[model samples]
Target: MSDNDNRGDKPQGPDNGGNGGGGSNPWMKSLLIWVGILLALAIFVTMFDGRAATTGGNTIAYSAFLDKVDEGTVKDVNISRDMISGTLSSGEKFKAYPIPDSTLVPKLRDKGVAISAKPEEGPSMLMLLLYQSLPFLLFLGIAFFVLKQMQKNSGSGAMGFGKSRAKMLTQKEGKVTFADVAGIDEAREELEEIVEFLKDPTKFARLGGKIPKGALLVGSPGTGKTLLARAIAGEAGVPFFTISGSDFVEMFVGVGASRVRDMFEQAKKSAPCIVFIDEIDAVGRHRGAGLGNGNDEREQTLNQLLVEMDGFEANEGIIIIAATNRPDVLDPALLRPGRFDRQVVVPRPDIEGRIKILEVHMKKVPLAPDVDARVIARGTPGFSGADLANLVNEAALTGARKGKRLVAMAEFEEAKDKVMMGAERRSMVMTDDEKRMTAYHEAGHAVVAMHEHASDPIHKATIIPRGRALGMVMRLPERDSYSYHRDKMYANLAVSMGGRVAEEVIFGYDKVSSGASGDIQYATGLARDMVTRWGMSDKVGPLEYGEPEGESFLGYSSSRPSRMSNATAQLIDDEIKRIVEGGLDRAKQVLSEHIDQLHTVAGALLEYETLTGDEIKKLIAGEDMDRPVPGAKVSSVPKAGTSIPKTRRPNGPFGSPTPLGA
Candidate 1:
């Protein structure tokens, strides 16, 4: 840290006055242009006043001059090209315009007034030059200013086009440390080596091992990739240079390449620094995807980045950390072994990670005694670090809106509902028939979930409208699973189709509403994945027919044309349909067998508008109880105390463990 104290004032880029490409500051240059315009205007006004001669004369009309001559009172006269000036008998200097007449001068002579014709006094040579060139000068000045500004804003300005746009955060400024970043402990551990290398390169170099030139962070969005890089900088106590991928490219060609070179040059001077490029896929897409026939600007930029990462000369003391969600689209050259030596994957947080993330985010907010981070985390599956942070903020906001001083578990539940299903549409008015229909639909989903052991546990079932849905049934897993088995997949499909089955069974097939549109779509997709991706179709055998939409290098998908014939394609479709239909039949059977239970649950829903999972379970178990009034709040659902058993898929990751079946 002490070593970096003096380097804090080091030059950054053109924006910070570090000389690289151009000298004139674009903003200052614009100011000078405007100042020139104001000066030109002031000079024009002075010249106009000089011509008026307002201080030297009392103005008189031409007829007055003639009248004075007729009275023989005019003493002297002076005539110019279009004006007449004379001294009257009263000794006042008068100015007037002369009329074109031959008799005028003769009358002046008969009056015995001294008359003389004076040559017009022309403007001086300097003023004359200014008069001729003022418009051109103003135009040139304005044009120059405009061109510079366009270049500046367009990212192709002569002065700054090649200069790096990276903003440096000094040791003191970069206050983020490993302590602030929660979740993804494995990624943090992997990056710890980078911190060690930056702190003392000799420790690794002496052992004949060169430090890695770069590390690429691959993850879904909002997974704390950038935050990890900042933590590395804070841990190593070095300067951090940050920039976005889009900042490198410009409308003008070759500018992006030049910026890459300038950025590396800056990083070299400030050695032992971290250069973080967020969303690197923007500039590092596969080459030869040309716009028309030739190489595009982005390709050239990526080429330069490739060379800079592992050029002929060593890039000692500089570590590049790039984050991208679309690693599949990145060029092979940029991700080669020598270029980006390490690839760290930052996936969504599991249950444990989610709890840690919640703890980190909740440090600043005041919470009630019953606010448990573990319960909230268990309820939030597939949540990234950013999402968890947002959940905490939203819960605080919900409490504030209710005039509460401290956030309670109730607010957390409300916040989770808002984040997952969208805000409640309390203002939406519905008829009694619509309410009853929604209640039945939700009860169908809840009952189906309870009957299917492989399916997740029901968290809540409500007829109240949320987001775009008329009703919602939330299913949350007690613990994390990395993969899904066929049983679970089938159960999930059955649960998704339960609403449509219930509607068809109760209201008749033709009378069923379109509220199950989303459910059908989800169920269909699940069935398709089972056939094409999971190889669960007996006719299709153990072969995958679907071509993923991106490369699978880091578990990302890329698309390819299908090689199967029309007959095989037809078989795949048939298998998908068979799976979906089987699930539908199962859901219908479960609902038909327990029609009485469905009626009871739906009745409770109509009475309360909402029902907790425990309450639904009790009602389905044939328990009789006093129901609350229509507007009374229902008791909070019990927290899940332990994780459920997880089963692994045939050829998938450990398990597909997501909170609440997101």
Candidate 2:
């Protein structure tokens, strides 16, 4: 099992790269130092020039120029009252002024031929220098800092072209082991071999078996792909290099490729290590197929990755593990032999798996003894590992909010409902008539599920508004099963249409409701699949309509086939219609046979706002009915008191009040 499957320790941040404190870039520091020096020079120039403010004119230079002009032999002289004067030198008059003693003493002894200075009131050269240079310097400093900050925030340094963006977690950092990862037994078994290979590569080498170059973990997000990779690192006790696929791409063209190279180099240095790339499809997408110019930086990075995986010397202990939900979108070359040769599917957890996941996450959380993880798992059919973990956390929060000390079974059920539908909109005001109608609609669904379908049982039926629905009837499978039988599909369709069927039978017509829109869509889809895909209808025979040619954008064909003759197409359409009408008829017939019971259940639903499968069973079997045979327990009803009566069977009449004695 992968180390991530274990939940022995808390997750820690990445290790400090040998350099020490938090890994700041030396280049950034050097750039900041250069900026500081320039800023200091600018400040010094401004401070010394404060003297030139009051003494308007070129203070030092003007005084010195006048000293030279005064000391020279004057043949011709010109002066104006406005302070415009000329220096007489060799019978030629030039503009001049009196020299100050401070300037004359130094220049006469220093350099000859000094220029004249005038007391013209204007801004000083130093003041102009300060005015112009300061803004430019300020702009330069600001721009430098902003760009540097942006680079740092982007997980790379400014001009960090060659650096790898992969986050490294040493063995000491990750505490999660195989025990934490639950539910994905197949994925764990496959990863266990990887751990074994990493621990002792020579064992395989002795048998002339080569370790897989890479393993691609493909599944939906939140299925613990990255966590599984971390588990491998923990188990193998090696450094784990982690990076997102998007980390490779930047505005620069070849930078992504450079980053890929750097990452591989680092992984090689760590030798007996694992490199986990999350969401690898971000870079490994099918090349030359995007809307923009055919040239893609991501494709280049992917190509470089291929080369790195194959071209380099086959290091015995190094392994590459990548994860992506959209594995179908990845480059074909990347999936070829020797590069991601093995694909492990991290599917959503089954009932047993979910229970195990719950047990793992529930360890830290204070849970009531009555809380059963299996019950919670059965309630959530399609929950992933992350979803199960979230359910536990949500249950804990719900418990705390209700002033409870520990998470109880009731809180878990509430959390499951919240996760499946949404938060209950208790604030949504419904009139008496509307509430009654919603109750009938939901009860209709529950009744059909209870009577018509023996495989899938009604979990809960509620008139409470949640998300886009005014009411909802949740039906869960008796157990986790992969392949759906034809009978089950037909039964599901009937249950889906139960709402509309009941409305027609009870009110003589259907009342158009936004709530039933999703149900209707589901029912119609199932009927269409029965005719075209599943071939459940006699008219369609046992032949599939066949999947469409080329890739479908929504994973289903939007355009109908144009090749078939009109008559044949009409037959197909009629067959689809017949299948749907037949299912609806079955639904109506079932609801009609138990019309009185449906009303009873609907009435209870209106009063209670929610009913478990047992409650529905009670209303259907009449007041004096015995407990039904065991099937599947849907949602649990709140116990009447501290003691849950033994009369509460898995599949039994609902609201069977607690027995007086036991």
Candidate 3:
């Protein structure tokens, strides 16, 4: 609960690598400069065109010009057929047009005004051409600007296709220090040295220590790998360049490679900065593993990245930090020492880490006194930092929906259910018979699980439809368990079979619905793992039979065919079935022995729709619950589900997946 709160930490650079997050781009400045130059050139041309511009000489009436010529007051005269111009006796310049002008030249000749027969000096050919083409030049400039603007808008403007999309984050944007990060403290400690080195390199240099070149953050999704990198940058007060690995791959050949070079160029200018490539597996895959041709765009991008990291010329003070969930797919060369000098495993947070993470997130919320972070952490086994953050957000949102001043424990419980189990689906209509069957199914699970000493305790049981389940029983582990015990696995299998067992006992074999599809699928998978992988089956000794991932990208080997002979494969299958049937039989036996308790639990579910673990115990003991009776749901009229998937855990393994029977 005392974990330092970084609720305010929202660090918001690269290569002054200033083209960062919201920083100014050099290309944009260049574009503006070109526009200004074109404008200045157009103005210059308009000012200098001799023939198209006025001479700025004074004008006089034609009759006055005649009077001047007659008086011989004009010292000199220059005349064309249409007009006359001369310096008067007083040496002032003047110009006049001839009226009914065939005699204009003759009059000028009579006056002896030194008139030239050549038409008053017309503009040069070069000037005429320039003046004529000015409009077209302006049109082309405008077209060029529009084209550049369109390209810029699409992020592929003139010369923009090859520019790096890496955003630079600076301290001024928002400072996110190590304090902002919670959970995965080991990974934080590993990265802290880098920040120290960046802040004062001489501290390490004096001791003959060279700054580590790179660090690879390997973890599952939502484990806070990217967040840690930003925290390092914030702590060190250095430029942070962030770009997704996918941003490097472009449809156009050479574009990706060009971007890699450009990104490094920007990073070099902002030396001692960190360049973080997120989801690096997108571009940093094994080069030849599944690549169609030797010279594809992604491969080229990867190759260029390799050169930039450790090429002929050294890149000083530039640190490379990359993140990926699938480190197995990354190229080996990229992982060599001096490149990614360290591989920091940012695994899912443990129970203690989760509590700290909860504390950090809770600081932003108005939490009720009853909101114990420890309780929430206990229920959320296998949750990552991102999951805990999301849990807090969901709880706050739930509280706001209820117009509560503070987020309470009830809201956190509901948010957890929504996060792990699918959200409540009360609108999915069910016939009374379906409802009764679901009640019996969930009751069987709760009863059978209660009988298993090794099984995790039931947290909640609901007959109301949720996610894809018509009903479900959720189990909360006493503590976070990394590896499952053999007994626990068996208990899980029995609990999984409980729903089907209950339906068969009450409704008979012919009346059983397909509601057990997800359970059966989960059971079969678990049993197979137990037999083939865990070596739980005595018949099949401990040996990995087949690879879970046999499919690979670009012909790469991510899988191996089962090495066991046909007969051996058949034996493995038999063991799996045997394990499953054993669990099912155990479930049947437990449900039969506790038949009365199962009925009581089911009746309570029908009455209340949902019950906590203690409530179930109380009802079985013939005690009334203190809570109010469940009311009808607001959206209970029945709506066809659009979110519920065929599988119980549709969102997959990122967050706390809907546990078996949950």
Candidate 2: tens digits of C-alpha lDDT, residues 283-303: 887777666775678777888
Stretches off by above 4 angstroms in model 2 are: 1-158, 170-174, 288-294, 312-317, 510-514, 546-558, 561-566, 624-662
TM-scores for all candidates: the values are 0.77, 0.73, 0.75
Q: Would you list the clashing residue pairs of candidate 3?
A: 13-168, 13-169, 14-17, 14-168, 15-266, 20-168, 21-168, 151-157, 272-317, 290-554
Q: Report the C-alpha lDDT of model 1 over 1-662, residue by residue, as the tens digit.
A: 00000000011112221123444685576677689799988987787786666335777888877887898777898888877888888898888876788998778888898989877678899988988888798889788878966775555566776887877755434367899878899999889988887778889889898888889999988888878877786788777788889999887789899999999999999887888898899999888754455477888899899888888977777888999989989999889888889999998888889899899889989999999999998888888888888889999999999999999999999988888777899899998777777877887888888889998888888887887888888888888888889889878888887787666666554667888888878877788888788788778888877776654454644443358787888888887777886777677667766776666777788887778888888887866545652321122211122121222223543243222222
Report model 1's TM-score to 2 decimal places.
Answer: 0.77
lDDT of 1 at 423: 84
- Full-model lDDT, candidate 1: 0.77
lDDT of 3 by residue, 265-294 (tens): 999998878898988999988877763676
| Candidate with the greatest TM-score versus the true structure | 1
Cα RMSD of all models vs. native, in order, equals: 10.2, 12.4, 10.1
User: How many angstroms is residue 500 displaced in model 2 relative to the true structure, after the best TM-score fit?
Assistant: 1.1
Candidate 2 residue-wise lDDT at 590:
71
Model 1, runs deviating above 4 Å: 1-33, 63-93, 100-119, 149-154, 158-177, 230-239, 246-259, 286-301, 359-371, 396-411, 426-431, 509-514, 535-582, 622-626, 629-662
The whole-model C-alpha lDDT of candidate 2 against the native structure comes to 0.69
